[model samples]
Target chain A: MTRLSSAQRHLVRFTLNGKPVQGEAEPRLLLTDFLRQTIGATGTHVGCEHGVCGACTITVDGELARACLTLAVQIDGCELRTVEGLAPAPDRLGVLQAAFRRNHALQCGFCTAGILMSLDHYLRAHPKPSEAEIRDLLSGHLCRCTGYTPIVQAALEAAAELAELSRSDHRDV
Target chain B: MKPAAFDYVRAETLGEAIEVLAQHGGDARIIAGGQSLMAMLNMRLARPKVLIDIMRLRELDRIDSTSGSVKIGAGVRQAALLAWPELATSLPLLSKALPWTGHAQTRSRGTVCGSLAHADPSAELPLALVALGGELHLRSAGKQRKVAAREFFAGMMATARADDELIEAVSFPSGNARCAFREVARRHGDFAIVACAAVATKDGVRFAVGGVADVPTARDWPRLEGSALDDALNGFAHELDARDDVHATARYRRDLVRLIGRDLVREVLQ
Candidate 1:
């Protein structure tokens, strides 16, 4: 059998953080590599390339996925969200980010981005998650520092803040 | 580690996918969710000349429920099955077992049929399929066949699926049986050291044990009360010949199978 040359590349177009993005990559290029190198979205870290660690977790088409395990070409027409997309503005952090900071959820900050991204998507579906449910979500992630106490606290606070913001928006309308 | 270079072809239909698989034969591998295949490829554990991406075959992504059975397509993601409300009622054992297969992110892209086809002995899907008395539908270019879950899984990471055959769907018998799933793992989403799935019917109970044998094993038990059931469970556990692994000793696994088996059986019976 003939082997495909590593130099062979394919053109891929997708929506990244609500903006159209296009790049050239090999069919074997992982989404984590494409995001970090091609599109320059380095917030999605590659901890364990085998998908055991959740550091490369991102949202593909609004669903949480491990970028390291997903092929770049497979998400050709999908919308993707990385940790860079989580901030509401350049000057200020997003609600979850602010809560993370307030709760001191980071020590080394390596696993923070992926944890934030996972919780960002999780809290959307479960705005009022119980403590048990929060722990269950955190089970997908691995954090060596902070012992997860602060991270869980931050998630709970963010959920409350997000819920409060939605309530206020409804009141104003 | 990065995966070795491989050509990719996205098939627009099931027929096209089958034709490509036949043409490439052993050189090509079908990829649905890429949850398991990608990991293998990255580790250089598997390297094929071509990857036949079948995610575009939307025709193989439906979930159909008919009188006492539910057919889940090969492309149906694990998370989709978990979220499907009908599954809770139709296949209660599967619903209880899916969450333990992997975390939310992995389940979001992992396919139910892919997990079964991968045939990992410690995987929750195969154990649940065996306990539920499921049948897998395998299709080639012009021929198709159904294999029982018990017979389909030959051993760890092995199945009866031929090189040219694709798993089109898996049909599971649905019933009003009470069910329970229990597994002891290092973490919540990790592979189980010993996993047991039990489905209790009015007549008796069907018990399946994973991570303790070459392949997941299922047995039907008649209604036996008190010491009779305990003695039977002990004998069944001893028959497994559970092997020592990095995670556990053979004796530990046997003990877990006995203890967890009785607990799960009792839970389902209740």
Candidate 2:
């Protein structure tokens, strides 16, 4: 058993956004703080620290997780992806981000980071998701802006675009 | 909100975790998924001196069905169980209720045993356990014991589990016991204001209600119809002793228990 006392910070190493990162965290330090403060990946926003708002949503080992609910020390040796990893390039937006822009999916943008992360992970698994399915998935996220209609539209449009891209890629192959 | 400072222990084995629990007792909290506990920690509802991470205990992640019951281990997350291929056929009640336990994000990390350990009155898992007559397998450093779901949950946020004992697994009996579930909540993933689950029994149907009582309570009834069934449901609803809270009023809960209870029992019976 590896026991770290609460009196001091301990070394925590993990892969963030496909890049290796290390930090020091006390036992009580949440992963949300670690990502933003220690790793300086501020794209993962924190809305409700109690895991209700879903603003801290991210992927740990490819599975969607609430960063606030996860302790920083517990994420050692795991592959994590945050909202920072969503866009393929810093200068350009990804397909989903572009879709959100076109559909006017976000307003305040406090909840967009988490919603995008969730949709990114969800759309990958469900390429042909129905509007109801997208709505159901979005239930985890609480959005005050756009009333979620545009968000759903953006997700469906993105899914269709991704499917078309995949089909075209297969043809080229 | 931030959690109070605590020591962290990543147990390499079940014996190690049990030993730590045996030493620290109530001061030590075992964390698998931390979906519920983390919230408690952040809100300072649970301030343990030591948080034991049992997620690394791969041996405890099994979902065994060889014994004719679906035995889910402690490390088995809610999403894993929901994604189980035989879940719909083997444990239909869980299939209907798991989606209501939490959202997809939290379910990916929330464990089945963890939810039972939290023992929230409005949680769907405990209600399903009680309605299905499941068993909770608890272990300490010295010994292990199996607890009936009905007897295991003592009250809201409470259980019969000793501080030194960790829930190893929970087994739900797999059979064609026609069952149905329904919950009334403000949001899709919010805690239920009133949730009901019914399963066909030998003589009749057993109705289990959550979010109204301090604990999920189940009562079995012989086949009855019309006003007779209505009377039984009314009695059961009153027996829950619900109170007016921010989410719902006592009268509203009682009405739900009677209305949803009647619907679930009918569905299961048919």
Highest DockQ scorer:
2
Quality class of the docking in candidate 2, CAPRI style:
high
Worst 10 residues of 1 chain A by lDDT: A1-10
Q: What would the per-residue lDDT of candidate 1 be over residues B45-153, giving only the tens digit for each residue?
A: 8898788888778899999999989999999999999999888888888888888998987999999999998888899999988988889999989999999998899
What value does the lDDT take at residue B175 in candidate 2? 71
Give the DockQ (2 decimals) of all models.
Answer: 0.51, 0.92
Candidate 1's C-alpha runs over 4 A off are A1-7, A170-173, B201-203
For each prediction, how big is the interface RMSD? 4.1, 0.5
lDDT of 2 by residue, A1-173 (tens): 99999999999999988889899999999999999998899999999999999999999999999999999999999999988888777788888999999999999999999999999999889999999999989999999878999999999999998899888884210
Error of 2 at B188 (Å): 0.9
Worst-scoring 10-residue span by lDDT in model 2 chain B: B171-180
As a whole number from 0 to 100, the lDDT of residue B86 in candidate 2 is 93
Report the lDDT tens digits of candidate 2 across residue range B1-270: 999999999999999999999999999999999999999999999999999999999999999997569899999999999999999999999999999999999999999999999999999999999999999999998899999999999998999999999999999999755999999999998999999999999999899999999999999999878898899999999999999999999999999999998888888887
